[model samples]
Target chain A: MLKFTEDHEWVRVEGEIGTVGISDYAQEQLGDVVFVELPDIGKTIAKGDEAAVVESVKAASEVYAPVEGEVTQVNEALNDNPGLINSDAQGDGWFLKIKVTDASQLEALMDEAAYKAYVEGLG
Target chain B: MSQDHDVQDLKRTPLHGLHLSLGGKMVPFAGYDMPVQYPSGILKEHLHTRDAAGLFDVSHMGQAALVGPDVAAALETLVPGDIQALGHGRMRYTQLTNEAGGILDDLMVTKLADDRLWLVVNAACKVNDFALIEGALDGRASLERAEDRALLALQGPKAADVLSRLAPDAATLPFMTMAELDVAGTPALVSRSGYTGEDGYEISVAADDAEDLAKLLLAQDAVAPIGLGARDSLRLEAGLCLYGHDIDEATTPVEAALVWSISKRRRAEGGFPGAETIQRQLADGPQRRRVGIRPDGKAPAREGTPIMKDGQAIGTVTSGGFGPTVSGPVAMGYVETAHAAADTEIDLEVRGKALPGRTAKLPFVPQRYYRG
Candidate 1:
């Protein structure tokens, strides 16, 4: 199941492992993604902590960790092709994979239907 | 009530409604609610301006006219440009300086007549600029702030062709020259100069008639409304200095690589403010200088990014961003004199990492000004 954070990050969970990336809405607002600084593998992060940076033509934004976990891997292909975030923000553009520290944290996030309504409220 | 007051406090230009109608994304800039980009986005807006004509509403800029028999002479005391020698219909780029040789503001002075001169200054510095000019020239000349006038720029390679349709005489005016003409039945002061490096004209019209004139210009097939986002990127690619960012009260013209604007006569006579320090820097190099920076990779080194030489911090980027025309990242910053030379290798600290870059000659894209 995929859960979204208020900060616009999304995580898809399978067993104890979760894949993290920014939402399509976030990528659309950021314009063309020129570069991304991914967190190092094996680094532990707490929920809501700044874990990555995404730079566009005009500005840069920080992406936060939605749930506490230890990073296991990062998308190495982003170094050469950051535009993937604009093209496929949720799937191939996954920023990192981590082992969830607490499964109960997922319940606190918004599901797809709720996330859509939340984004509409912002508009 | 305070929130309502805040909204009312933000000034609006005459073209505000037009921008909204065109799908412009409004944002607060220099206390004005201005359009940063349109539905086309900044990238497309930037590229479009390079290839075709772009109409920009610069009504927020401060415009004024100095009228007096000795207006030019009086103006010279505040700025470093050769205003007295400026021929009628010619414009000169200059800066207001302080006692310490630092720039107060960069502005354009146009000689409209022997006893009258026109001025255009940055939006953010206008209030202070007007007060300084008025205070300095009080007894010698009268400064009339043109708050009732609105300024617009038609820029890009196709600007002349599109504008000439209305004011046939505008095409003959050489670069840096101005003329009083009629556009769409409204009287205007048209100058063949602009912030963009492309051939263009800045037209000053009555505030009440601004929207009508804009509608007429937008009717041209070659012209499109451009926002502040593209304006910034265009100026950056053209190697122009943005007053508050690339230059401020702490920087002198010589250090900003704008010594060319200081005419040979002004350099020799040295009567303007801060002449002593400026002359000294002209003879001997300044401690720091502004230069173009080209980052090696895709990541743009933004403003406040530290420039390092062999692990030692030397300077910081003042204006840095992606150049849509160059198809890569480009920036400008002040660096220690030792690292100011073209082709000098340096590292830019971005997000706690060092990115390789090299000093480059300005105007990442060659200027296309219509000199003739």
Candidate 2:
């Protein structure tokens, strides 16, 4: 299942492995993703903490962690192809894959339906 | 309510509503609420100008006049440009400098008449610039703030032909010239200079006439109203400096690669502030020089990104972005004199990872300023 943060990061959990990246709305807002600063593979991050940074031509933004976890893998392809976030934000654009340490942390994130409402309210 | 109040506090241009209606993403820039980009995005808006024409609302820039019996002499006290030689309706790009030869602000000054000097300065530095000019020319020149005026720029390869329709005489003015003309029945002060490296016209009119003038200009099929987002990218591609970013109070004209703005006559006369230090820097080349940077890959080395040579930090990027016209990443920075040469190898530390970079020639995309 997918969960989201008010800051626009999205998390997809499958067993204990969770994929995280910015949501489609965030990608659109960022316009073109020119650079992505990925965290090291073994870095530990807390829920709602700034884990990475994304830069477009006109502005820069911080990509926050959706939940507490240890980064097990990062999307290295983003180094040369950051635009994938704009073209396929949810799938190929996943920033990092984390080994979820606490499942209860997911309870704080908004689900797909709630996330949609949250984004709508923002507009 | 506090959040709403904060939003309202963001300064807005006269055309803010029109921008939002056209799907512009509002952003704070130089204390003004401005559009970052429209639905077409910065890249598209940038490319469109290189291919065609882009209309830009630069009304937020500071416009004012110096009126006095000997305005040129009074103005010369503040800047290094040869203001006395400026014929009527001629413009020169000049910099306001401090005692240590550092640039306070770079601006354009035009002689509209024997006793009138029209000036346009960067929005962010206007307050300080006004006070400086006012203080320097206290007795000789009277300052008239044009807070009620709006400035619009129409720039590109087709800018002249399109704008000629509104004011037929405007097409004949050469680069760096100005004239008062009528556009679509509205009187405006038109200058044949622009920030984009394209042939263009900057039209100055009353604030109330802005929307009407902008709408009329947009009615042309080739003209599109671009926002601040595209403006930065376009100027970057043109190798132009953004005051606070590319050049600041800490930088001098020689160091910023803007020595051309200091005329031969001004260099010899040496009457302006900081002339001693500026002339010395002119005689002896500056210690650090600004050079264009071409990062080898897509990862852009943005402003404040450290630049290194042989694993030793040397400088920092001043302005960096993806050049739509160049089809790659482009940046400008101050590097040590030895490393500022073209094709010299360097590395940029972006988020702690050193990306290989090279010293490249400026105007990463070739400039097409109309000489004729």
Candidate 3:
């Protein structure tokens, strides 16, 4: 299941793990992704906490955690080519994988259809 | 949401419709609804400008003329640059100083004639600047604000090739020189200068002719419409200071690494506002000096990030971001004179982490201005 947050984060849930990254809308608004600071594999974070930091040529933005979880792994490929987020924001650009500790928290996120409607209103 | 100003209250430039047609993403800047980027994004726009040519709409800035008897001498009273020595067709960058040795604003002064001087100042400070200039030069000279004019900057390596095609005389103009010529059938004041450290021209024209001029420039295969996003990064990489970010009312020319703009005559005579304080700093050196910074890693240390030395706070970053040409993060900030030397080890406090950094020489990328 794919979910999105009001802050423009996205999470792809599979079994008990959720792979997180910023939504395409967020990446588009950011212009370009030059640098990305990701959380450690074992870091514990709560919902809405800053899980990663993305730097564009103009400014920096914090990527928030969509739900409470412990980080299990991070995408190391982004260290060299952060532009992957602009090219493949939802796929190869995934920031980290966290083992979801509270499944009920996922229910609060917007689904793909709902996120499209939400972003539409913003424009 | 783009800024504190309401969207309905934002002013649009002459090229506002053209910007929209080119898929520009609009953002508010200094009360104007300016384009921050186009469909190409800032990274591409910045690199493209370094390699090719980029056209920018800077009409939002205040344009005016100081005319009548002894205008140059009159202007010298408010600024530190040597206005009397500035030859015809030449331009000089100087600051509008306050009484306390701080910069009220920085602007370009172009000598059109002995009695006429053209000026370009920051958009946000125009109202205050006009009032200050008129009040100081009262009866000595006349301040004529040009509200119907538009300014466009054409910049990059290929800028000459694109601009010379429009105005043949522009091809021979050297850096810091201006000419009253015709560009695309419109009368313009063309100067071989710009904010980006590239060979370029700044054309001042009638507001009604702006869109046509922009379209003509953009029609060139090498020229693209660049927005504020790339302008910031380009200027940052060139080691130039943005007014509000890197310079302000509290920062003086000496501490901002802009002492070169102060002429030898002005430095000795000490006639302008805050001259006593400026002379003192020139002799004894300033408390803090602006220096370029390079983070050891990829993370960018943005504006307001504190500079650390052995866990002690020494200064703060005023301008910083990723440089598309240098392919790294670059920053400029003020640090104590003791630790301002090139290659001095420092740390940038971003968020809660102290990122390792070192003070580096300015213009992360080599400035390529064509003098001849």
Instruction: Write down the lDDT of every candidate, Cα atoms only.
Output: 0.91, 0.89, 0.94
- TM-score sort, best first: 3, 1, 2
Every model: Cα RMSD to truth:
2.5, 2.6, 1.1
Number of the top-ranking candidate, with DockQ as the measure = 3
Model 1 clash pairs are none
Per-residue C-alpha lDDT of model 3 across residues B104-138, encoded as one tens digit per residue: 99999999999999999999999999999999889
Q: Which candidate, 1 or 2, would have the higher DockQ against the true structure?
A: 2
Best by TM-score: 3
* Per-model chain A TM: 0.98, 0.97, 0.99
* Candidate 1's TM-score: 0.94
Across B1-372, the per-residue lDDT of candidate 1 in tens digits comes to 001225467899999999899988777788888888887778788888899999999999999999999999899999989998899999999999998888989999999999999999998999999999898888889989999999999999999999889989888889999999988689999999998899999999999999999999989998888889889989999999998899998999999999999989889998888999999999998999999999998889899999999999999999999898998899999999998999999999998889999999998999999977
lDDT value, residue B361 of candidate 3: 98
Could you give candidate 1's per-residue lDDT for residues A10-102 as a string of tens digits?
A: 999999999999999998787778788899999999999988899887788999999999999999999888889988999998899999999
- With a 3 Å backbone cut-off (N, CA, C), the pairs that clash in candidate 3 are none
Clashes of each: 0, 0, 0
Residue-wise C-alpha lDDT for candidate 2, range A22-119, written one tens digit per residue: 88988998897777888988999988787889988866788889899999999999987888999899889999999999999999889989989987
